[model samples]
Target: MNPVLSSSEVGVKINEWYKMIRQFSVPDAEILKAEVEQEIQRMEEDEYLLIYFSLMKFRHQLMLDYLEPVTTRIRPTIDELLEKIETSNKGISGLLSYYSLFFRGMYEFDKKQYMKAIYYYREAEKQLIHVPDEIERAEFHFKLAEAYYGMKQSHVSMHHVKQALDIYNQYELYKVRKVQCMFVISGNYIDFKRYEKSQPHLEKALELSRELNNKRLISSALYNLGTNFADSGDYEQAEVFMKQAVEITEKEKLTNLPHSLFSYAKILFKQGKMNEAIQVSKKGLSAALYQGDELFAKLQGYLKALYVDAVDQHGVNQTIEYLEKNKNYSYVEDIACETAAAYANSKEFETSYVYHQKMVETQTQIQRGECLYDF
Candidate 1:
């Protein structure tokens, strides 16, 4: 414990460190870890400082966990932070409530619980009125946009992203965040199949990301541009951009490696490079399986399509079995449709008819929004 410093003084020091973490300016990771441990120890003697320290640590850890490929290691810290926030008094609680809610939203977002994230984010929004910091508000909106995007609510995602952009544009220091907002807007346009609208945003994001010398941002911009072109039937342009994105993802060991590879393989398939597409899709499936459940599902869809086109009924059967075992209803219709077509080609009318019926039923449930699976 620091005998010379009062609780308020300790809070001030914690706040300074918190700002540094938020601004992505922490100088040395090892040193910062040591300092954080020391501060946490001191918190044993000061309740006020404990609240501030816990909030700041939670913020820092949340950001780190978001960047990590797996989050199991950080779960204990997150739970402890939530407990600390819940037990605090009104005065200290008032100061930390928005951050607590925001972190909870991020935690859920990272876990791929998009609807739960949206709920926590909405709760945070109610506390925003008391928090007068424009930059913080912009950050909150950006996070909300991400949650909406994860839920495939593209219009709502665009709305929140635009709000974040409006605020970020007012501050020169927030140029990076503004560029990220542009990327999100571009993605939303792509989701809506508004390729023409997505082009300028991707171009701007690419230019800004290059200028900032940010490999991840540059790769993401290129990937989005590739997806936009592919969706618009521009196979040549899609192949060029997607290959660049895949190269960057591979060299940088980025989490988007599987996604980029899948996109590139899709372009190859569109360009009639059957052998290359199948090979690349197989590699992407391996990578996606290691990455996470979401990426794995996406790769399964790609591989299923590739198998259907290649006339590899065995491959299709294997993928369908996996999907069925996992109860992945979102892709059930597509898988059934493909299986039906494959059987029809083989002149197996009875089996084809069975799968065709399954396809129709799944499609109807999807149209009625009664399916449990979501991408």
Candidate 2:
């Protein structure tokens, strides 16, 4: 068929190739892919459309093959896109919108809010409709999978991710995101405790993260690889990644360094070193409070538990006070509350009876929030 087409024809062919790529007829598809490239080359263009076509059309298969060592160059792509996307301008374009959503969504996923990240991905997917590009569509699907996987929905996430991989293999769009999807798939396996299943994905993610020189992705992939070892009780290997996480944070001055510290704390706790566990928990909480408010709260809960176990009543009281001040604590979350209840339990029977009655009233208020509002 016709490989080199005019501007209008190029648009038509992009959508056509996307459909063909999805259908998995690789040999027939490549002929058109080559033609599309030839046409893109012939045009006296200065826009990113051809490169976009190169990625969005084929998706990134051979592009993966050609990746040079990742360097500071890729960092500006992130920054420039971020600036344009602070508000919707025509210059950002539909294609770039897809990429921006992906970049930001991955950041959100790392932050552990799967729902909000998925919302960004949906926005990305919506913008993709205007471009009608195949490789980009596949990538969008893959990112959606990543978001879903972050939500702990593995099966559906796996299906979409494979669709991205299949299309990349077929059309040869092998950019960094393609590599990212591979790592994310491994993460799904890790989540399911299939450590053997995750090795290949982690291996590739590490390789590509280096090639991309993407510090954020490199640290993330390393963390996941280390997590697999940790999960299998391979503390030694876990230590390796946990160390990498720390190194990255120190170098980048990145605030989200709690995961590594917390992992280290758990390992110490398991070893029966209560002192080390308390120390690590405090360190993690210190960074987490300013860096990660949502997660810091949970880490503080653990810190409080450690205090109680260590028989530090004053420390436990302080932790409870902090949690209450934050308004992010649960009364039944830890033994501390039960311990307080026990203290009340040991008091005079009449005092215990009064406390028990307050519990009933509190339960009633909780069950009828609207009634409280009504009164």
Candidate 3:
């Protein structure tokens, strides 16, 4: 338990604490944080280990917030810690500089500043030459993949994820990250409508998740499988998988509940269960709102489609107003197309033409990789 007596002991303790703090709950992280801080203080002579422990503490807080979706507010303690890291001598250790950049990138990523996150990630990658640990390098690549994925650059994301996976495959301790990489790769395939290719990855992820007894990963695998089945027009299979995902998330109060509910609602809408879809969408919308405005924006698009089908022009107009107010460009193109069709169905030719043109313009902008709306 005495971390200061030996350098090797400190390294082992750091890794142990890192794994413990990675649990998906605030209370669990709090316990590990206390233990880590005690050990770090005892080893105050080791500045390098001190910085590494500090970064782990910051990462623990970030992971807790991400998993719970309680608040977007960054704690002042984290900011203070960053300031200390910045003021410290950089030549003390390359890991000090590497982790500083890495944590900054993660902070930007949490704020949805994907481009800024990528910039910091690149800077951190440059410092990786000093890092001899392949596991740490793979971790950086995994984070870069997530940043690119958020930017909707699927090809770039896939490339980084593949690199991470290749590294992870060489280490047993990185099996969890390997499963995560598979999930990201499957997501990229899904984005391209390659459902057949996506399925095997999800299946593998599901098997691995089960073996690891990771409920969150299990739910994620099930949810993605549901999306694949739905996209491929297999409503029965989609419903079964999505329902299971929903149940697991709701039971565990997982952060993925809102997304799973939205997917389930979409499947219901596609099956013409309009009332059921509306009910589920409403629940999902409320959950998304609790999570954050960004999540709310994504969930609203599905609800918009449901309203257009079941309600009236007024319902569709309401959805349009909501999206416009929020300025979530991610769905503007889809909303415009839906609005055009809804108007066309009601014989409002003038309105239909206007929205159809709007849809076309949005599509063109999206195709050109331009920022058409303020998302």
Candidate 4:
């Protein structure tokens, strides 16, 4: 409660605040954040501390953004912070430099720029020597795992997640991180087409989320479980889990409500519930549009076109073009293959050949470094 503190004391407080933010201790972090901000002004003479405070502030904002992504204020401030840190004339310490790269990777990750995120994360990994704390190293590994997983590098992701999980499992204060590690591990297994192997991790994640009373994690677990089931051709079971996920996300106004709805629509469609699928897709599209989620909006738009009366070939082509322009080769490849199979089933050999060609080209692009593992 002292209004004035020495530089070392302030450093201690800031480090404590960083821990709180990483743990998702919202209320405690907010209180400590204000305290640190106040104390920081009194020590403006310490340039290193100032840079450290700025970095932590950026990270705190990221934690807040994760909770309310639609209301994020990270864009302008992130660039400004990066500029300030890079332009500072004072010699940067090793730890400060490491944080600069690491946090920027997190910013890119938040934007869904997986390749860029991995680039920064890899650069930061080189500075791991500057970060002495074992737990901080675990944090870095966890972030790298997420970026790799996002880019579909399952083996690399599994490696990093296991590293992070090993450390996180040792700390009782890191239950949230443990849950996240479980999700990443499960997701990697799902991507490897080992659905049965993925289930136990998800089940454990679900159990831990419920014990923590964290709705966000609970909904995520349910949604991932639904996806696993859907991919395994168990639409009925997928529907049960996805519906619960949608209900929780919609009621709680979670950021992933649109994503849950999107998955639910696919599940319904796979089960031959055409009418319900159309309705759910429409709802997802509306949610994505409202949230200004251009990626999901475009995806839902394509699905809507496919679901409407006759297959809108032109619309499908236009959306595929958009996805390709955005470097979403995986999505384009998936859609193109599906379109090709559908046309083949309908005996439209010419159209099916065109789509098959498109799929092949996208796969080639994926293999040629135009996409996938771009780093």
- For candidate 4, write residues 1-375 as lDDT tens digits: 446567999999999999998898888999999999888877647777888888899899888766644544443466788788778744675788899889999988876677778888888877899998889999999999998877667788899999999999898988889989998998889878899999999999999999989888899999999988987888899999999999988877777877788889978876779998999998999898887677788888777666664568988888898887767676788789878887888899999999999999987775563443434
Q: What is the lDDT of candidate 2?
A: 0.60
The true-versus-predicted C-alpha distance at residue 133 of model 1, in Å, is 1.7
User: TM-score order of candidates, best first?
Assistant: 4, 3, 1, 2
Candidate 3: lDDT over CA atoms?
Answer: 0.73
**Candidate 2 similarity to native, TM-score:** 0.53
Give residue 128's error in model 2 in angstroms.
4.4
Residue pairs with colliding backbones in model 3 are: none
Tens digit of per-residue lDDT, candidate 2, span 190-303: 767799989888878888778766665677777777778877878777877767866775476554467667766666664566776777778877777755455555655555
Q: How displaced is residue 159 in candidate 4, in Å?
A: 1.5
Candidate 1 accuracy as lDDT: 0.71
Q: Is candidate 1 or candidate 2 better by lDDT?
A: 1
Better of 1 and 3 by TM-score: 3
State residue 87's C-alpha deviation in candidate 2, in Å: 11
TM-score of each: 0.75, 0.53, 0.77, 0.90
- Candidate 3 structure quality by residue, lDDT tens digits, 1-375: 644555556667777666654324456557757766665566547666766777887887777655443444455455677777767754644666777888889888776666678888888877898878777778888999987766556788898999988988886765567778888888888768899999999999999989978777888889989988987889989999999998888877776667788889878876878788878888888877876646454545546654634434555556656554443333555567766876787798898898788778755654444431233
Task: Output the TM-score of candidate 3.
Answer: 0.77
Better of 3 and 4 by lDDT: 4
Which residue pairs overlap in candidate 4's backbone? none
* Residue ranges of candidate 4 with Cα displaced over 4 Å: 1-4, 68-76, 90-93, 360-375
